[model samples]
Target: MEQPAASGPPNVAVRAAEKRGYAVSKEQPERPGRPTLDAGRSGGVTVVGDPPRRPHARQRISTTLDLIRANPTGRIALKIFIAIAGALVVTIGIALIPLPGPGWLLVIAGLGIWAVEFHWARRLLGFTRRHVHGWTQWVTRQSLPVRLVLGAVGLVFVATVVWLSLKYSLGIDVVAEVMHYLATH
Candidate 1:
């Protein structure tokens, strides 16, 4: 009798093996207790995550310069107006320093407006950045009782000024006379 063919068609062999409850095995064993890989991580290579990004100081300065350069005449004129208006507001705010309306905020805004165009203003801004946080921290470190007392005093001062302004602007002279007396005597 002729011996069975040692080599047969691959599909036939596969079918025969499957009929016998046998199956082809992969090269490596699948590991347990690990996250499954998806299409983005199909390859065997491991990828490190990227570091966080931060804007550099020079980049900020260059962007500011680019903004200034973009508009030749219009921006310059606008900056001039901002400087003038900011100065006027700051001057009036300073006059009201002993009264109310956030004098320091107006001054800071004035400097900020100038800072858009001037190097000196930029330096001042940098100076304020360095110290303002520390100053605020110091103010907060004061005793709670002291803070309450100071806050009450500031509120009273603000209320007095608002009352005087409303009274005088409405052509009422009594509050103005009282202020004049307080200033002189």
Candidate 2:
């Protein structure tokens, strides 16, 4: 029998092909412990690796924002737009606070919108996020009975507020109306 023919490693052939500007795959193969610079979708250079140093969501957002704010005139315009939009959202959120709706959620969303342009808003958002997390943790630590009691108290408080708001603001007495309707029916 003839001796077996020697064959070069598959990777060596692939690497040679790569040097000749011929990529077998659309996605370039990533090697461990080495970083590679690749062209990004937006025509920017992106560094990728085994442990890829991809842009954070915030970084990407800021980058897009920065592009929009390259000139002083554009920057001022963006700032104004953000401020107006954020104010409107926050105002609506504040208005909805006393009503049964996503008041806090809208408020946080407004803060996020403001955070895109304002450092103060970013700091306040972080503070609010921390406090909310703390409150959630504290509530979770309470006993089931305590939690239920707290919930009931909250419900009572909300009902009382809603009733008072309706009675004073709109001259509508819901409880009396309900009683009258029930009695008649």
Error (Å) of candidate 2 at residue 29 is 20
lDDT per residue for candidate 2 within 1-185, as digits (tens), equals 23322222235544655575553332323434344444454444444445634545765565456544645576799999999999999999988777788987999999999998899999999999999999999999999999999999999988988898788779999999999999999
Clashing residue pair totals per candidate (backbone < 3 A): 0, 0
Model 1, runs deviating above 4 Å: 1-64, 70-107, 123-134, 172-185
Deviation in Å, model 2, residue 23 alpha carbon? 35
TM-score versus the correct structure, for each prediction:
0.43, 0.66
Error of 1 at 109 (Å): 2.3
Residue 152 displacement (Å), model 2: 0.7
Candidate 1 backbone collisions, by pair: none
lDDT tens readout by residue for model 1, 74-108: 45776788678868877876766655568778777
Residue pairs in candidate 2 whose N, alpha carbon or C atoms collide under 3 angstroms: none
Using TM-score, give the best candidate's number. Answer: 2
